[model samples]
Target: MSVSVGIYSVPLVCEAVPQIGCGCLAKPVLARLEVHPDIAEAWLHHRGDVIAIKWLRELGVDQQVGLLRAALGGDGDSQVALVAAASSSPLLATFPNPSYWYQRETVDQLSQEEAHTIAARLVQRLSQARVPLPDGTALQCDLACALQEVLVVDEAMPIEARLARLLGVARDTFQQHLGSQALSQLDAWLTPAALLPEDAG
Candidate 1:
């Protein structure tokens, strides 16, 4: 007997991207969709409701059709599970762990270089797992370049803009509080006088 792997032959619903609340999943999914327009069209055509449920079931996950439907409809909880499934990440296992939460906070508090190191480790782990990237080589290159730009800080863009991009925040929002928050924090260390030695001549 031959075992089947891949998408099930489910009847199509409507051709439209289902709104999903998990932003993390959204990015990877969109990236994959861009590289594989056929898959994207198939997903949208199926409305994601049946697809999500069927996929989970195939994986032996005890998922509720209603919950999967809610996930496709942008429910936060269900979206998290779906994302975990897609990435082969232990997001669900760690979701309730205080230590995991603390680690995330600690990473956020680390210096840019340190955070970049952590991000690099994550990318390496993903690679080791042999998880299929959304678009393969091109998308991988784009992500690498983006990460490098954020870590190196583009001289052309203002500091606030760079920070905003790294933090995935809006430039306007980053600018609004830049003076009081980032600028003030950097004032002492980054000031020219701090870098220049006192006159000794």
Candidate 2:
């Protein structure tokens, strides 16, 4: 039988890539991430995004933030090792709703290309708020910090207690600048929803 690896196992396929600084991961390829606890919780809090759901379900990692953290390579592991170590969280049941991305109303009304365009625009608008970072040698510090909030917890801080502390930092920092409005918007937009299965037709 042929093995069916989910999107999490695949590389990101982006036609137009962003400018990445030195410390950032090389190439915009899609890879599994070790998401921090809070980050996972944060992802769960959002309404929709099937891609994230499919990855989580297929990986069986439970915590999305931990996935992001692992992807960040906070540990000294080589790139290959890091990818191999990503947790595999499986889907236990059908998602509560069809993937927000492919909802019948939107998909039926819009062509695939148009749907993607709309989604991208919405994501851009929703994430407009700036996420601040502590000054340091790392380039794209603000973006990195924001990315870290969504990144999975690093292996360096594998234990729950340490992970919790890291989460505390994220919540406190975001809370201060974002306050209620920013947090509300993030909750509305970035939360992962269900994605249509690859074979769905």
Candidate 3:
């Protein structure tokens, strides 16, 4: 069963996504975040796109945002981790009008695309100069910050190499999973004449 619909209007500082919406908070993606102690219970619906979170204690907006950001990935500059929560749900959530990125895929579909998703998402972020969250929060999203949000490289690694590392798989698997366009985009980004030459290339 899904979270109770009536509770969605309780208004615990809803951070509705500004534009079309974001997959960052999508149930299948961000919903996989760790549910901290602050969250008493969570329910996921609409393919994990929309979530309802019951707080253990009352928290302010900043606290909620900070906690969610921390869970999404605050270990470094940008990397959101894939965590397994000991709860009925996998995401850090809260009550709202019941909406987020609606990807509309089943659990099997999500798993099928899970591999290389982090890397691909990082690559995808390259296109957006600004990253928006569920509550219309916009953060300056530069290449380095974007990489920091997802990929972790202890040693030196180029953009492609780092992305590959984030993929956590062989080249064949990455190609098979993400396909040619993502790779081609990476290649294009790496070119000397690529856009944002001053930034990560």
Candidate 4:
């Protein structure tokens, strides 16, 4: 008997980027739709839907499809590359230190150098991926939104201060708000600003 591995296929439904919400586009525009919960979880975790919509605007449905196709773990190479890249990044590296130190007397957790290094790595990966992101205004907006979600989960800052910097909000703010009602709000708040178009820029 022969065995199979390293073979993958995206449902025809995934061929054209699905319009996120309320567009004049007809339903079932693409064919053979199939979605597994695991894929949905991964997409949700990484805010992949938002990322895909933004990319679709420039690259068109075809290119978006290509990226998604390539993203689906061809020969396990693409999956491994994405996983290695995400795991090796510094943001993930420094994420745990602060959590471990929360109750300790030491206020000094992540160093300025550490912060800068992680930020640089994120930027570098974004650059290396060669993805065309939104302009500064749009990027800033998106970051602000993402940061806000992070703060909601961490809930350590004054709401006023929290609103001031959305994307990449300071680590201090994160530590302060780690346990708050904001987290509850997140569960109920379904549509994130992260999913909005960058047309504001």
Q: Pick the candidate with the highest lDDT.
A: 3
Pick by lDDT: 2 or 4, better one: 2
Error of 4 at 108 (Å): 6.0
Candidate 3, 35-88: lDDT as tens digits:
465665544343432334456666664565455555434423232122334342
Candidate 2 residues lying further than 4 Å off, grouped into runs, are 1-123, 127-140, 149-174, 193-201
Q: lDDT for model 1, on a 0 to 1 scale?
A: 0.30
In terms of lDDT, the poorest run of 10 residues in model 4 is: 22-31
What lDDT score goes with residue 133 in model 4? 36
Q: How far out, in Å, is residue 139 in model 4? A: 3.7
Ranking by lDDT: 3, 1, 2, 4
lDDT of 4: 0.27
Q: At residue 17, give the lDDT of candidate 4.
A: 18
- TM-score of every model versus the real structure: 0.18, 0.22, 0.29, 0.18
Q: lDDT per model, in order?
A: 0.30, 0.29, 0.35, 0.27
Error of 3 at 84 (Å): 28
- Candidate 1 residue-wise lDDT, 1-201, digit = tens: 222122211222211112111122222232333343122221221122222211212334334333333333443333333333443233333332333221212222122323333234333443554543343344334434444445433133433454446444212222333334443333333322221123411
